[model samples]
Target: MRLLLATAAAAALFAAPALAQDPGHDMPMPAQPQPTSDMAGMSGMRSMMSAALGDYAINREASGTSWQPDASPHAGLHLMQGPWMVMVHATIDGVYDWQQGPRGGDKAFVSGMLMAMAKREVGDRGTVQLRAMLSPEPFMGKSGFPELLQTGETANGVTPLVDRQHPHDLFMELSGAYAYRLARQDSLFVYAGLPGEPAFGPPAFMHRLSIMDSPEAPITHHWLDSTHISMGVVTAGYIHRNWKLEVSRFRGREPDQHRFDIEAPKLDSTAARISWNPSANWALQASWADQKSPEQLEPDENIRRWSASAIYTVPFGHGGYWSTTAAWGRRTSAHGDLDGYALESAVRPNLDWTIFARAERVASDELALPPGAHGPAVTVGKVSVGAVRDFSLTPHWSFGVGGLYAINFVPGALRASYGRSEPQGAMGFVRFKLD
Candidate 1:
């Protein structure tokens, strides 16, 4: 108990500063007129906004102009200057997360990502869009973020991180797309990028409205959306009203240890997804992917993955809402098949307080342990609950302090390494976000 308290105190120091704004989707910024001296940049931006948004004055989340029928809200910097409509999302999460059980400890770090996108109508024909995303983890460290039992990718970008959350690359994503509107509610588009995501899983957790309040990566990340950083990806999609069909071909190799450089592109993997937004308050998807060689250490292994998920959000009072997600996924490999499931949710009744919980069961590998500790496939279950107190430092940014405790259920074979039958972990963090 004392340790947890100390951890929380340290987290407070980490939040001394931070982002410009959150993605508040409903907030609208009045367009600034063309420039005069000090406003030159505003003029150019205005011109870009006019060309892209047309009469689409509101911001809606989804890929390109393929609107999510019931997209959740986000508060972001919306630049609607001229011919371009642009959106920028960024945040720096400073964590002092301390986990107790088997693979837990006083692990901490400050990591975040910045993503910017812009679109413009092309010659009265199609909509052209460009996106850039970056994170500074490459030069930061090799161990990446610490999360109990979290495994995938490599820590050094070479050896498997084993039980840690892999750091995102400095260039998380660099991509572009072109879309042609066929009707008021229909469009066809093509998107391509280096270090991009295929049409496989839900938007990566960081971007998901359901789990945005938590700092730790979901243990099921591997089975669900591990391909968020494919070396190369080309996606083609058709959107009709509240539904979208997408297919993609992408390089399957995980990024090598050299975080600063781009990996070789193989275009050896494929995936498809069907997304339905039955209403403006819910989103659903089913997806499948075949990755030829996603991990460097397991070059001979081919992975076939499938997943389905439902996300829902309902606005409440005073800038608050209820958001949740439940997802299931599976991976089939030569070794065997493993299933992963997660259900998480958060509710904020007001701006200052939030409550959240998560429960997950995932397949873990004993082989991921040191060579001598190798065993067979192991299944684990964990449940956690947490809350955060946000100090609204400003209208656009906020600092928060929160803690979570988790209970784990482990199989006997894994007991030797975990040290006990049931281990528990706890984390405390100072979270900062563009609010």
Candidate 2:
């Protein structure tokens, strides 16, 4: 907690002089030169946005070292101060959630996330980025909201949490990256964070365009991107043209029940990944990791995880796009191998309306078992669809209201435990975002 506060203080101090120069305005200025011919031809506002490593547009960089389609739209407040480019993205949701069945529960709670990032070019050939992401989920309480078939992490210090989504820590990420351009289309970089993401999964669900507006966490989270909030991470990678290869060493244990304090850091896990953006509309990746002990209650279990995913996006009407993602993941341990698959899509037909849907199936072993017990995995599936209507409140902010309905499928063996073969769940939420 102290470290997180100190980092934020230092960043404010670094940007103080620039902010003081123009006390009357809170908008971006063209504080740096355009590095490429393509960027030079863009409009002034577009050109002033930050240039990522290797002179790529910053919009391409997603959660951690992940990449998304270049044409994907970004919603944030962007500004340039002195030699630094700053971007802030945030969303808050007041939600009423209900899951129906014998094992289901209901809750009304609030959840939100805020991310701030700053970057600067170093002597023309290098770029440096510093990022901090915080969440108010801790205020949602430790047990978090109820979501049928969701698993992983613990709600208390001892027992594992099943069929419930755990709240994220107050400090979700505090990380830094440095990239040195080796050629026009190539770069080498290193990233390290006290609490950061490793290069082992697709962009975290919250960061993906396909499900960004939805209020529920995916059931396949553990199988796919559960490591998004590792305690310690160090990664090195090389990027060439549209392809990137990276490797990381990070802490494998999931965060403890405490959601407001920092945990000790360790680097006991290893992972490697390869990513490719074939064009402006496509992004793909494959990754593998040897996790030490990903579950706090199951300390002796070591699992090998593999994941592959592809995302596609295309522009349609003015300021609108359709995005889709197909992903598959698996984990192998002494108990057995469990697999998960997901398909998610979202469409913004216009600026005022956003629609999204997701389908997921996972082999879940924790659902029917007690907190500290292990059993054979059972197959469970969920399908959800929803929409949101947005109203612009100001130039830099927007308010939205949305609702979603989901149907969950469980196998015959577990039907009795869940009270039905198919359980239903739904959520209605009002949201506010910094645009």
Candidate RMSDs in order? 7.9, 5.3
Candidate 1 local distance difference test against the native: 0.69
Off by over 4 Å in 1: 1-71, 371-374
The Cα local distance difference test for each model comes to: 0.69, 0.83
TM-score, one value per model? 0.84, 0.90
* Lowest lDDT block of 10, candidate 1: 50-59
Residue-level error in angstroms, candidate 1, position 355: 2.2
Question: How does model 1 score by TM-score?
Answer: 0.84
Q: Per-residue alpha-carbon lDDT of model 1 for 1-435, expressed as tens digits?
A: 233223323323332222222333332233433356567655454334332222232333443222322435544544432555555556776776665555656666776776666666676557776777777667557777656667777665346776567777787877777777787667787888887888987777777666767777888988888788788999898877767798999998877767788887779999999887787678888999998987777789899999998888877666677888898999998878889999998888887998888899998663346821335778888888888898977645688888878877778877777778777777777866653
